[model samples]
Target: MVLPRNRDYFQIFLASLSPMIFVVLLLAELGLEWVYSLSIITLCYLASFIFWFKNGTKPAAWISKGKLHIRDGVFGTDVIYKDRLESMRYEIGHKRAVAGSNAEEAEMHILVIKMKGFDEWTLPIKDLIEHGPNLRLYKFIRDNFYNLKLVKK
Candidate 1:
């Protein structure tokens, strides 16, 4: 089974912009021309788009037989055989809103598969509207790994 990346555009934009706006303002305060500061911010955003958009073309994860494959980067891929998997967990990472705000931002739900004698693999959940679209894929992963762990006990 192959899984989607499940990226949200609004989150990415906010993440990339929030820090950028602050830095640009700081630069403007530190004697840099406003035009140059704005240009710098624009360049940074362009770089981010180049990096993220290009990588969105690849598969985020796949499972074949008992092997789990995860894409790390353009040339880095990690593979873990089912038999070597130790334990697993799912977690939601959140971004606490500013002190004055009454909101929290959720980044992505991550499924962590721990394999024996190797580093754990963290893969994002694909259960989003345009991604996995349901819990079917999530259940598929949980059931498979849970059953394996159960049998080991």
Candidate 2:
């Protein structure tokens, strides 16, 4: 059983940064007309959005050999085995989180996995939205861990 990584977050991250990126480009060019710069930026943003929409999300993960291998868009390839799997939980939004967090940074259904003798981890669900719906992922985690097959790769 190989699970694949979702790359929807790549587009979301790019979209969020596009405005600042455009402003930087516009300002870097000396004496450029604001209107012209804005136009260029707008076009770039549209093009980038279109490109991502057309080819959004990557399926590059596997859960075979008793290990979960994922190609994270923000990080990189991450591999964790069954033995390391401890437990799983959900992240509370900033407002509801006991520790508190920025509302914008908090998203629902952020999967948190705990490992034996290790820190907890988050599986970004917002990034997976573009690839497809992720309701099934929760179920999968529940069913797998419920069986307590945490041992060895």
Q: How far is candidate 2 from the true structure (C-alpha RMSD, Å)?
A: 7.8
| Native-referenced Cα lDDT, model 1 | 0.59
Any runs in candidate 2 off by more than 4 Å, and if so which? 2-60, 90-106, 119-124, 130-134, 142-153
> Mind giving the per-residue lDDT tens digits that candidate 1 earns over 29-88?
887777887788788878766665656555556788888666654445667678877877
Write down the TM-score of every candidate: 0.47, 0.41
Which candidate has the top score in TM-score? 1
Cα lDDT of model 2 by residue, 1-153, tens digit: 434444456655576555667566666676677887677667777776665554344445546667765454433555666777788664434122323644434243465678899888766544444222544444454464334222111
Overall lDDT per candidate, in order of appearance: 0.59, 0.53
TM-score of 1: 0.47
Angstrom error of the Cα, residue 80, model 1: value is 2.4
**How many clashing pairs in candidate 2?**
7
